[model samples]
Each structure stands twice: as structure tokens, then as C-alpha cells.
Target: MVWKDETKEIYTEEPKEENIFKKEYGNTDDEFTYIEKTKGRDGEVKETVKVSIGKVSRYLLTKFNFKTIFGSKTDKIYFYESGMYIPKGKTKIKTEVEYLLDNKCTTHIVNEIIEKIKRKTEIDEDLFETFSENNLDLIPLKNGVYSIKEEKLLDHSEENLFTFQIPINYNPKSKCELFEKFLDEVLYPEEIEVMKEWFGFHLYRRYFIKKGIILLGEKDTGKTTLLDILIGFIGEKNKTGMALQTIAGGSDFTKLSLKDKHANIHDDLSSKDLSDGGGFKIATGGGHISAEVKFGDYVQFVPFAKQSHATNKIPPNKDVDDMAYYSRWMPFQLDNVILKPNPYLKDEIISKELSGVLNMALEKLKYLLKKNKFSYIKTDEEVKVIMERSGNPLIAFVSDVLEESENGIITKEEMYQVYSEWAKNTENLRLSKEQLGRNLEKNCKFIIAKKGTQKQGRYWNNVNLKGNYSTFLTSKKVIYLQSKDDVSLLQYNKNKSVESDVKEPEETKEEEEKIEQVKIK
Candidate 1:
């Protein structure tokens, strides 16, 4: 076809078919190229274009910077943008490719380019985990990114595919008086310090200090507000809102929700007992998590989020005496209640004082980095109180029923019998006798030793029931045991030795034998 440039006062001819295809799309000579169309999709004359396979692949692979992660049942592609890489759905990418080609390429053609780009840009899945924790990719803020080792901002690079970002720009001198008032009114001085340090820990890639936080308080208390501040401080996109029950439930689907989240928030947490704490321990204890995407590949990554929970009632724990389990929790109970709550006050603080809060958290993080550990130390009494409030049945049982004395002694059988009865009467969950023995030794500091030659059993020394089980069994009369055959009640003589009664009737003897051989059902 011949075309004339009337405005230029010259006559020119359109390039031949083979010549046009040979011409590069831009000044650079690249494998991928594009060409203009003389007719529109409706067969009308118009200015439109269609892209080649190489052209579309190059555009997507360069413009969006898509990285393909393989080595799983299914291939996955993540596009880098906004200081992070986001998982892009295949269906969406196909649509985008079709648009660039003016819907000229078949589904097969589009798929071919997509797969070509992915294979050419394929990266080992392990690189995601390694690069995420690299010092240079530690913290990606809205204005700039930071390294965990320094406060200076590093130059932005596409190689750093950070998935999490602090929404606000870093302003070391930012201040908000309203946020200060809210914190002072809600948390004690020590609690505020702990809160700041905990928040600071969320901005990093690796968890140097692994501990979950729980805020205990009643309704209208500032517990939720305090945690909500953390949610705003780290932006909603960086947080995963899931309950402790779900996180510790051992469901891979639930576990997948924690990947790359800055915080796992459980606001208004339910009062469910934590039946399994293994998942919770791994989440806050810096162990790698293997979570599978539903109908997709399994992703293994170390969790970077800090868990924070706000609850009206502390949840019960199955592993209450497991020090390894309980040690991961840091509790702060909110005592102040905002009787007249301003609903918009939280929003106001986030909008005005969020940057200041970030700065405060940064200072706390710096302090922790200098010390190489968390500095907020809880008093012994505070620790005890927190343990007790966490629905620890042993603590309550020990306080209300047991006593410690230098000369006190009780057999394991007798102690278990008393504990079982006490648990039944108090409607508490009864632990196994063997577990009770371990708890006694670990918590009460009581010595466990084999009984004397008289019987084959073990006895707990220096710990006994405050009230004798004899009275607990019955209020009828004093009963004494002599030579393993004794009535239900127990009695000790002046020398604390067993002795028989003066008269031994046949029926009384039979009753004593039955009591001695009685079985617990």
C-alpha cells in the first residue's frame, strides 16, 4: 500500500510486509517487537496495534518484573511492585496478555508466552526465604527501606521483594500529644515501655526476640484500643487478624495466613482453651512453618509477625506447667476502662500520631538491639499473677487445698485420691496422676522419694493437704488404720504411728478389709 505525507509535502510508501516485520519496535534492537494495524477489530479503519509473543513476554517480564517460583506441585508467579512482590493469578495475567495483543493470540499462544517468561525468569523457592531475611531487605517503609543493622535508608532495588511495608514515612521527630495521653491513661509506665519495644520488634525481618503478647481486660477497657494502635501503626495490609485457637489449631490452611504478616492480631479473643500449643510455640518461638496453600504448593517460611491478643478472659492452656510453652507469652492487663469511649479517637490517633508512635517503637527497637535481648523484666509476683490468671488449675488447686511444711509427708496414692476428689467437687478438669506428680515436683519444689520398706510406693515429702482427707471422706467418727486394713478415715497417734482398736468385731473386720481393698471407679 502507498501512503502520502501530504503535510510534509512529500510522497512516501508504507514499508513492505517483510520489511515492516524486520523493523524493531523502538530504537533498540530486541527480539520482541510490535507493529501498527490498518483496521480496527470491527473491520473499520483505525489506529490499533497487536504484539508478538516475544514482545508480550518481554513487556510482562520487564514492566511488572514477574518472578516464577517452582519446585512444587504447581508453578507460581509473583510480580514485584511497591517494595514487595505480590502473587499474580494466572487468569489475570492471561487477560493482560490478550489485551496487549488486541485479543489476536489464542489461549494457547498466551499460555506459551506466559510459560516462556516464567521459565526464563524461574527462581529457586528457597531464595524467597533467604532474601526476605537479608540485612538489606529487613524493613521497607513507605518513604524508604532500612536494614536491621543500621538506621540509614538503602537505595531501592527491584531485587528486594519485600511483602510487608510500614505505611507511614519515617519521621524521627514526629510527635502526637493525643496518642501520649491515650497511652498514659491506659497503660502503666512499664507497660507503655513494653508495648513500644514489642511494636518495634515487628518492623524487622527476623525475630531476635520471640514472645507473644496478651492484653487482659474487661469490656470498655483500653485493651482493644491498645492493640488497635498496633494494627494502625503497621498498616492493616501488613497484619493478619486470626484468633489464637485458629493459629494453634494445627491446620495448614490457617497457618498459611501468617506468611509475611507483620502482626497476628486477635482482638476480642474468645475464651476457648488452647488445646494444642505446638503451633503457637513455633509461631512465636522462631521455628520455620510449613504451610500449604489450599489446592496449591506448600510454602515453608520463618514467621516475622509478632502475635498480640486482647481478651476479656484469659484462655485456658492444656500445657500450663510446660515452662517452654508458658514462657513464650508476655501478659499485660489493662486496668483502666474508658467509660465514655470516643469511637473516632482511634482513627484520630492513627491519622495524627501514627508516625510518632513508629518513632517511639524505633527507639525501643534500638534499645533492644543494643542489649541483644528484651529489657522489660517482669517481677516474680507479676509472673505468678499472670500464670494464675491464665486459667492454670494447678495454681488454684495448690493455693486452696495444699500446704508446705518441713515435716509434711503424703503418699502418691493418697495425694492423687485427694486431688481427684477436689477436682471433681470444684468442677475442674482433672489431670492424670502421673502428670500431677510431675507438677508437684516442678512447681511445689517437693521431693519425691520411694516409700519405706513397709510398702512399694512413692511419697511426696514437705508437701501435704491443708485439710486431712479423713475429715473430707466423712464427719461421722475417727477411724484408724492398722496393718494396711483400715476404714475409710485416717488417724495418727501421738507418735504418728498406726494402731488397732481394743475390740475387733467380725463385721468391723470385714468392713476394714473391704475399705483396704476398695477400688476407685
Candidate 2:
């Protein structure tokens, strides 16, 4: 063999068959040659140990499936096991690698070997670009993953990175009678079907769709029980419990909690009105949300969690006319309280009926896909009424407490005073005087005009207080008017100038009937 050095060329004879054993026992110029020299008390060499760094590297590689995930700033080291790529700590990896060395080599040699092994195993991050939204049909289960759409078992791939596994296997024939009974007890028949679709949407990871479920009911109404069943179905570790108010406000930890979560369940929802719906809009609208790791930099990620909240008081929103926020909510009312609430009912349902529930969810998911939308028993008009009352305090106040006249005007100050008083009585948050004026013009088309006389301050046109609470209660000639598009100013008394053939909204009709019954009494 001939080789060129930096300064000269060297020639050497090729080894024969007799030299095969000699080549294996002795090393020539291989830098990976690991020789541990042990000395006697007299400082004389006692033994020469030959340690194969390649063997040690291979052993560590086989024992721990070390992988490097490339990042923009820094590479993350992880180990693959069960369908997850768990972050591997430097100290832990070093300790495992050291076990193979057994103190036979110097620290420098050990580190060199570890680095070489890492270089061999480290791969590009794009290689692991899997488990995307497109692959969400593959639901991870305890025994194995199953494709809900395909209705068949899927082979587990190394790219799968789900952290939690559902406890129950896919059983299409399974039936959950107890859970069905509980659903019937807590929700209307139509609502039960909506609940099925809700569960299936989460299972399918349909985060791209901008929708969420909100349940409103008083205490002991089985709201928590229903939410618990959902949490258990998704696996506790796969769900988060961030409050709706915090999420809407985009609190730092709220975004972090939602990462990798299949559902965000707020059983005890906050009663605070949602003044800021930006974060909520982004999350439910499939926009990338920023999450900051504890003591780390912020990272942008698309969250897959479906938000479900239950509250006694549905919080009012600042802007109900913003379809981006209100349209995302599918509200349902729960009134049937469990007479004798079973403490262990949730556990029983989860333990025995999860497989059945999964089957039902998949069935509904298919139906939702076919329909391209959710089928809700509660009409959109009904939901709009509930949202108006809970989302726009100004609209609710105008609808219930005020009346419009052919030629009427009320001072902005006086109207706000009356609104503030009514808000106090109704337990609604009153908007600021400035905000009230702006919203009145923008949403209600009621102009805030300056009076002809300089002394008379600005006043809203074409509307006035309905005398007093007593007069409002006794009024019978009132007629509700709204546009066909369901624009803002949900309800106000009809006048000659604003007449149309538009049918009255369901809520206004119901209120009118209630008032007629009061008059009859």
C-alpha cells in the first residue's frame, strides 16, 4: 500500500492471511484506538488494555435510541421510546455512556467517543416532520394506534411523537349505556348529539375549525361530571385546565398549558367578562399561538386542543358584533340537575365505557365531516340571544330597558346614568361612558349629535329611557326590529320610519309572550 504524507510518500507491504489475527490484536494509526495503560507501584507498565470505542459506541446506540432534533439556534437531543421523543438531558446521556466505558478510558477519550456516536445518530429535523394535522386521524391508544377514518389498525412509526395514549382500545361494537343516561340527564336529546360531535372533533384534532363549546348551568347541574368524562376520554395528561378568562387575556402560562393538549377543559369557568378576545380568537381560529417555556424563550406553535367550558354565569364580551369571537362559540344550556348525584359515576363511565364513547365519537365525527358542520339542537337565533345577553351588556340593556320614539332624544350623560343604574340592578358590567357612545354609534346607528343650543350637551337621537322600570314592565305596545343579516342593536322598539317585513327573532318573541302572560295575570 502507498500513502502520501504532508512531506513525503510512504510505501508498505499489504498484509497476508497470516497477519489477520495480528491486525485485530494490535492497532496501527487509527485515532479511535482506545488503549488503557495500567502501571505498577514502581511506575512500570503492568498491563496494556485494548478497549474498542466502536463497540462501546454501538452498545450505547443500541441501548438508548439517541436522536438530535435540529433547531434554529440550538439542537435538542432526545431519545425515542413508545411513540414519543422525550428530551434527553446531557447529564443523563453522559451517565449512560460512562457505564459502557467502566472507567477504562480517560475522560477526553470518553467524550470523543460519545461525540462520534452522536454525530452518527444525529439527523435533520425535517426527517421527523410527522404527526401533523393531516395525520390526526390516527388516534393513539394504549395497546396501539387506530385510524378512525380508515377503521383499521396503523403500524406505529418512529415519527409519532404523541406524549399520552388513550386508555381504551377502539371497539366499534362497544356501548356506553351509563354515559348515555348521564348525557340524557344533563343535556337535551339534540344537545347530546352535539356533544358527540364535539368529542369527535377533538379526537380528530380538527383544530383548523374555529369553534368551541360552552355549557351554562347552575350548581349541581352535572356540568363538572360531563367535563370530567371528556377529560378522562382524552387522558388527563393530554388535557389542560386553563381558565377561559386567562386564555382570552393571553396570560403567559395559559398558552404554555395548551401546547400538545388534546382539550382545554375549564369546569369552573371564570365569571369575569371577556374584554379581550384576541387570544381566544387566535387559538380557536387556528392561528399560531406563542407559548413561552418556563425560564426559556417564546416559541410559536399551532395548538390542537379543543376548548370546553362550563360556568354558572356566562361572561359578557366587549364586542358581541365581532363574529370572530361570538361565532366561535356553540352555547348550550343545562338545567336538569341530578337529583341524587352519584360520586363515582364519572369513574365508572370512564373505566367501563370509554371504548364505547370513542366509537360514538368516531361515528359522529364522520357525520360532521359529511355535513361539513355541526348539527346543534339549539338554533343560531337562540344562541345569538344568549350571546347578546351575556356578551353585549349595552345591547341587553337597550333591548330590555329602553324604547325608541319617532322624535325622541336623550342626553348621553342621562342615558349612561340610567344604563349604569340598570347594570347595577341586573348584575351586568357597565361600559365606560366614552366606549358606550362609540359602540352606540357603530353598532346601533344611533348618532351622538350636539344640540342646537350650546348649553345642551351631546345627546343620542331617536331613543330614550322607557320612563322607569315600572313603565318598562307594563309596556305592551313594544315591537322588536332587526335587520335580515342579524346586525347589531339586537332589539329596540319599532318606529314608523324603520318598518320592514323582517320576522322577529325568537328571543324577542319569547319575551313578548312572557310580557303578555304578565299582562294577563
Candidate 3:
């Protein structure tokens, strides 16, 4: 059978053989390809087509149909013919370009296609949704691509979905706020000033200041209460352990090893079993400790031993290695103070405020860490206040007196009074005078003693034996005197000695009167 073109009556023949496979070829001179159709065994004709010239096969199809099909007005087309019995039939054809870019469609239709392509090929819808909900502006690109402009997203003037600036007072009702409030209300102005100064110093220096603050006092002193408030303010992340039971064995030295999720709060440390020696250590380099652990048949030694009675004991005298470990920490003792909770705020409210403060501090700490700042110096006054607040009465008194008095100058009477009172109040104040004197010499550079005098014939003099007393008193000089009368000539014979001594010693009355008158004149 043959088919003729509608306009030109150009004919193409169909193949007669049942197994005939006709290959359609397009223009060899142009840059487009065409389709071919064949009748299959099921009495249905299957058609296949190509229109775009990407590879060489498609390029050859364009060359055949030069003027009519491959001309400027249209792309190339191919025709397949066979001289057989089957009839040639009309076929429906489509091209890739027409389906992809339908210019006749509206922008909404194009957008639908774009969205479908994005879902099928490129951008993740979940991420897009998240960004969108967060107020992020994301643009989809060709091939289902999405992009973000860094500058636009980071612009502070407009609120963006992904960006938020936490306000300083955002959580005013947080636990940290309560802590700050408590501190402000409870501490004296001077104490607050010192604490503020300390905070500033640490903040500016970017230091990891670990203060081993111990709160000591009687049961009613609010030690535990204060700690609870402090812990709440500092937040859970900042708190590592609450009343830690033990340190784990073979722990890393770079991080804290205490068990529990809160910071240590030994409510009544004095009442605790400290005989094992477990307590706070500060100012330790690396801020950690290592110990060996042995287990099972292999007895693999772990580096850090956790809290255990065996590990807490004071090392033996000859155990230099253990002593070195113990020397790395500074311990502070605290005395508890009684405080009544404010009736206005509920416990939950106070707790929330404290937590907020702690979180803020942690955030600040993280910021400081990024900047690589750590370590700070305390002013003398601040140091004194801290020492006093820690609850060592001796340290407190010393710090207080040091702040008030002139440097290196304490009156002897004042010293005596302070010492006498301290001795009377303090238990185990058994130091001998000599030991006390030595201690004074070492720490104070002064001598302590009672008054005494030395006698020389008719002269008695007070002796100042203070170690540096002579250095200050230069005018007083020591003098030595001897008797003028010689004892060797006084006695003579045994029998006549008494009479002879009497006769020589006697003075005439007139001589005595003349001596008296001369003495009076």
C-alpha cells in the first residue's frame, strides 16, 4: 500500500512482509530528527520519534530533508517506505521542546511544572517548609534548585525565620534572676561591690574562674537553700554534680569527672564523712585528676579512680606522686547563714529565674571560650572579702584587719589582744610561746614577749628584747660600772682585824661637819 502527502501527493509505500522492520530516517542536511511507525503482531502500530539533534545520529536525520522540512521555518522530518500489502496510516507526534516549554501556557502553569520538578528532582520540601515557617526567604532555581542569600538572611533590621536575638531581659522570671535578686538583697553594698568587681575582672579577662566555695554553718543556716538557689540560677548544664558520691575511675583529665547532674552542694560538709578526704580543689592546672583502676583477671588499670574511700585518704609521707596530685587543689570552707525566703515569690518562680541566669552565664561563657580568654586577678579587698565570706574566722579576721590597718604595722597591744581572744575561742590552740614567736617571726616579722629588766649595781634598766627593737631605738646605750674600793686591803689579821677596820673607818666629828658644809655648798 502507498500513502500520498496531502499537499504534494508524494507517495510512500508500506512493506508487505509480516516480519518487516522499517527504519525511519530523517533529513541528513538539517539539525532535527523524526519518528517511525510499524504494525506489530497485535494488529496495532507502534510509533517512535525523536526531534532534537543532540548526538550524531540525530544530526544525520536533518541532512536528508533539506529545503521543505529542514528549512528555516521547520525542523527536519524522515520518511520510511516499503512496497508491501499493509496500508500507511496517520500518526500523532510530539517533541521534547513543545512539552517542556509551552509558551502558550500561563505563568501559574509554568510554576506548577516548576514545583513538580522541584519535588521530583531537586529541593527538599521539608527543609523548605522549615525555612518558610521560620520566615526564611528561599528562591527556587532551575533544575529544582533553591538558594539563600547570606547577606539578606543575616540582616538584623528585619526579623527572619531562622534568626533570633535573645533579649538580655527576655527571661526576667528565670531562676538566674532570682539568684541575682537574692545576692543583691542579702549581700552588703561593700560585698556586692566586691563581687561585681570580681565578676568584671573575670569577665574582662575571659577566665575559667572555679571558686571552691563552701557554705558552712548550723542546720538552720540556709546552706542547702542557698546552694539550691545557686544551682537553679546556674542551670543544669553548668551544674555537674550535686553531692557527688564518687569520681569514676580512669576519668579524662581534660573534663570534670564528678558523678551527678548538678554542681556539688555538700549541705553539711562538716557533718559528712570527710575523713576519706573527698572535697573541693581549685586552681588546679588542667582542672582535673587521674587515677588508676584495676578490674577482672586482666586488671587493666584505669587512669582516674572515681570517688572512693581508698582514693580519698591523705597520701603517705613517702608517696610523693600522690602528694603531687593532692597539691593541685585549693579548698575553701564556708559557714552557713540563715535566710528567710521571700514570701512574694513562689519556689517555682524563684527556681525558674535562677535557671535563666545560669543559662545566660553559660552562654556568656561559651562566647568567651570562642574568643580564647581565661584567667583573672582579684583586687586585695575583693580577695579579703572572698576569704572572709568563705567562713574561716582566722582568715576573715586577718583579711579584715589587713584592709583597715596600715601595711606592716600592728600595735603590740592590739596583737596581744587579738591573739589572746583567738586563743581563748579556738580549740586546739596549743602552740607554745616559742612556736608562737617563731610563727610571728615568719609571718609577721615581730617579736612577742612580756616585760623584764636587768639589774646592774645601783642601776636597774628595762630591757627591750624585741627582735627588731634595738634597730628602732638607737639613743639608749648600755653602760658598765665597777666599785672604787678594793676589797683586798680591807681585812688584816684575824684577831686585830675588827678593831683596826673600825679605827680606819671612823671619821672625826669636825671632819664630818666640814664634809657636810662642803656638800651643802
Candidate 4:
């Protein structure tokens, strides 16, 4: 009934929800839901509950000094692009705010979100850090089912399909069968263990293992197959498809591309590919390499993703002579190949077998984390091949010609002759007198020009197992060639041509042509 004195026009308007905030803030009872957990010492347990004041997101935003204006008309959160609060209305708001958040979309909201993110972060912060860190490479947890972005890996944790696509039916047995089958064909039986050790290295990368891998193989040697499985497990976006040279000789754009990669492969390279200058010294964290955004401040981070190079021909031995750099390079030889390319092999492994292999790798990662130190099992065959192809004939020559001098001393002249002969015989580049002197001094603390008490132009003194260039290779100070058989290190080097053993070291187009002609003849 309408009152005659009062003009009652039918009026409908939006309901006022101001009291919703008052209930959570001003009211105490019947507001908060209390959840409790017990914490005690000495076999005792206690329980406690907290009555929180407001919505977690809003409370956190204010707590972190991130003041966002609630858009009345749009029903969205708005924060200035400059990470500030003006407390002004939406109409005629200054240009400081990049734009208003649209309820229609979460896209292009990164700037607003970034304004809200506090410098101090906890577990969830790490999850959000994928954008800022540019470090998206996923590491497997001890539980065999956790992402590296997670700060905590609980015992009750389970594998996540979205993170690195670790499969549902991961069979370790099947993985072993596939890996064994693959490696058995590509490498010697003894060296398979080394290959296994290196394969598992990618999983426990948070340990900051600086080691990279060199996979040397002919076509169809299962190297690409292994990489295919890796790419399947790790989504393409989380890796670099760019060439190694692009990464090595970096620009602002190239540095940006280095982000988010797990295994950055420099596929199918030859010695000439890295001939002008090389990347290992910087890419392996040998030096502090700086990267930056275009027209932005420069920043540097230790790269976690391993830099792998897959090639048919081996890199020059001398180029890899620095033990500090070379020691981190794990080289595997895959000489044998499938004569007929079975395109389905990749499908079988990635679709059917890879998940199992991933689980197997996770198991190894668990063990590695528990061990806490690198106890990589070194295979004799792997060691032999790694040294021979390392581009420095000195290591091979030492293994062949040099004996453990009783006095632990040797003349520079004596050593030079050994290297010279090895160079001529192996058809490798020879170090000049100055370069040789520098290398001896840099690696072994042996000064070539400095003379000893005896009649000598240069002397290597204080030579011991622990204080030499090849000391890190094996436990023994004596070279393996000390044995009576005295087999040449050439047997370990696969790609070396016996007939054209005296080829020149210059990595020019003309030089490559000359070598090809010799091989043809």
C-alpha cells in the first residue's frame, strides 16, 4: 500500500555490499573459520587456531605494501604501473597507471601483478618466479614427482603432468631396456655406465653441476633419438632450438633466448664450426658472462642448463686442453648407426618408453641429491676416448711416450719432441713454442724458459700425481701407457684417419678441402 502523503515511485538499485568487508574486519565472532595444527617438543603435541581478518589475497596485498584500487565499475583490481597508490578515482586518473585491469581478461595483467609481488617471497613466490628468473628448466625431486619451481617437496607429493610431462605409467624396467639397447649399439659395454651417469645429470641440475656433454656420432647413432625423448619430456618452449654459435656469440636477443632452456643442443657440428673462436670457456661458466635485455640494464646469472654439442667430427684436442674447462665436458662416442632410419623409433621412445626412462633418471637424481657430492663412476673406455679427442695431443702423447720420471722432473726439450711427433702422427694442430710454454706454465706450473741446476733450457720440477695437468683424470700419477703393451692412444680416437695422419691444423675451407682429397685418395 502506498501512502497518500508520500510519493512512492517503484525504485530498484544495486544492493549495497559494504557490510561484507565489515563482517570480516570489524566483527570477531561468527566471522573467521579457525584451522589448527599441533606443534610441540619432547613427545608432546599442542593445537592452535587463528581467526584471520580478511581475504588472504587482499590482506597480503596490503601487508606487502601493494595498494590496489578496487575498480567499482569494472570489478577488477587496479595498481599503477610504477608500483604506487594515488587513491584517485578512475575518471581523469593520471597517465602513471599503464591501464585499468579488464574483467574480461587476465592477459596483459603482468605489469599489475608485478606491482603486487613483494620482494620477499616464500614457496608460492618461487612458483610465480618463472617469469622473473628466466630459469624454467625443471628439476626432478627425490619423490620422483616435483617441479624445481616448488620450494618444498613433501613426502606425500605426487608427480605433476604439467611440469615436464613426466608420464603416468613410468616403468623403470622399460626405460633401462630402451637405454641399454640404444647405448649398447652406440658405445662399448664398459662405457655404457658413463653414458648412463651423464644422462641422469640433467635431472639434478639444481646442484649447479657445471658439466656439459659432447655427443660424437655418425648419422643415425641414436644421439638424435635421445634428444627427441628429451624434447618430448621437456616442452619445446622450455628449451633453446638456437644454434650453439648463436648462444656462444651472444647479443641482447641471443642472451634472452638463453633463458628457459634445459638442454641447449648445438647439433651436428664439425671442428670448423668453432674454428674462428670457441664458446666452452664462457658457456661453461669459465668466465663471468653478462647478458641483458635490449636497451635495459646488464645482468649476469650462472647458467644452469647444460650446453651440449652433437657432432660427427671431434673438436680440436688443443682447444679443449684447459683442464678447468675440459674436465666438465663429458664426451660420448656413438660410432655405430642404424643403416636404415626407422622414423617410428622416435615415436616408440617418446610416446611409449620415455616416461619410464624419466622415472629411472629421477631415481638416480634422488641418489645424487642424497650423496650430496659428485661420485661419477668413471669408465676406462670413456676416459681414454675423452682424453684422446680433447684436441690436445699433449695428453695423448703423455699417455703414450712419457713415463713417470723417478725424479719427478723433465726437460722442456724432451716434452716438446714427444708432442711434435704426436702432432705429425695424429694429423692434428701443433702448439707453437710460445703457446706450448704458456700451456705448460698455466696447467702444470712448469716454466719452459726457466732453467734447472742441471744443463737444460727449461725444466719441469716438483712434478707429482696431484700437481699436474692430467692429475684430475685418474688416481695414478703415472700415465696408463707405463704398462709394457704401450698401445698408442690413437686406438681410442675414433674419427682420426690413419692414412692421412699428417693433415694440417688450419681450420680454413682450403684446409678442409685438402683433408677431404687425402681421404678420397
Best by lDDT: 1
Steric clash pairs (candidate 1): none
Report lDDT per candidate: 0.67, 0.66, 0.31, 0.46
What is the C-alpha lDDT profile of model 4 across 1-521, one tens digit per residue?
21111123332442233311111113323223244443222223333434332333243444433323222232222232222222232221222222322231242333333434322222231232243234333443323334444633323222121233222343445554655565555564456665555555565433255566677665666678767666665545556655555655557556655543455766776554343234555555534446774555454544545566787655554444345545666676664444444567667666676656666666555555556534545543555446454544555544433444345655666556545544654455789876776765554323233576665556665442222332222211022122212222112342343223333334434433443343232
Write model 1 residue lDDT over 339-394, tens digit each, in one string: 45667778888988888987787778888778766655785355555756446667
Q: List the candidate 2 regions with Cα displacement exceeding 4 Å.
A: 1-35, 38-43, 46-54, 72-75, 88-118, 126-129, 159-164, 251-254, 293-298, 377-381, 390-521
RMSD in Å for candidate 3, one decimal?
Answer: 31.5
lDDT of 2 by residue, 118-190 (tens): 6777775644434545576778776568876678767656667654566667776899888877776666556
Give per-model CA RMSD.
15.8, 12.1, 31.5, 17.4
What's the TM-score of each model vs. the native? 0.65, 0.66, 0.33, 0.47
Kindly report which residue pairs in candidate 2 clash with one another.
317-391
Runs in model 4 deviating more than 4 A are 1-127, 130-176, 205-207, 242-244, 273-282, 286-289, 294-298, 317-320, 371-521
lDDT of 3 at 439: 49
- Runs of candidate 1 with Cα error greater than 4 angstroms are 1-51, 89-92, 95-99, 103-106, 379-381, 390-521
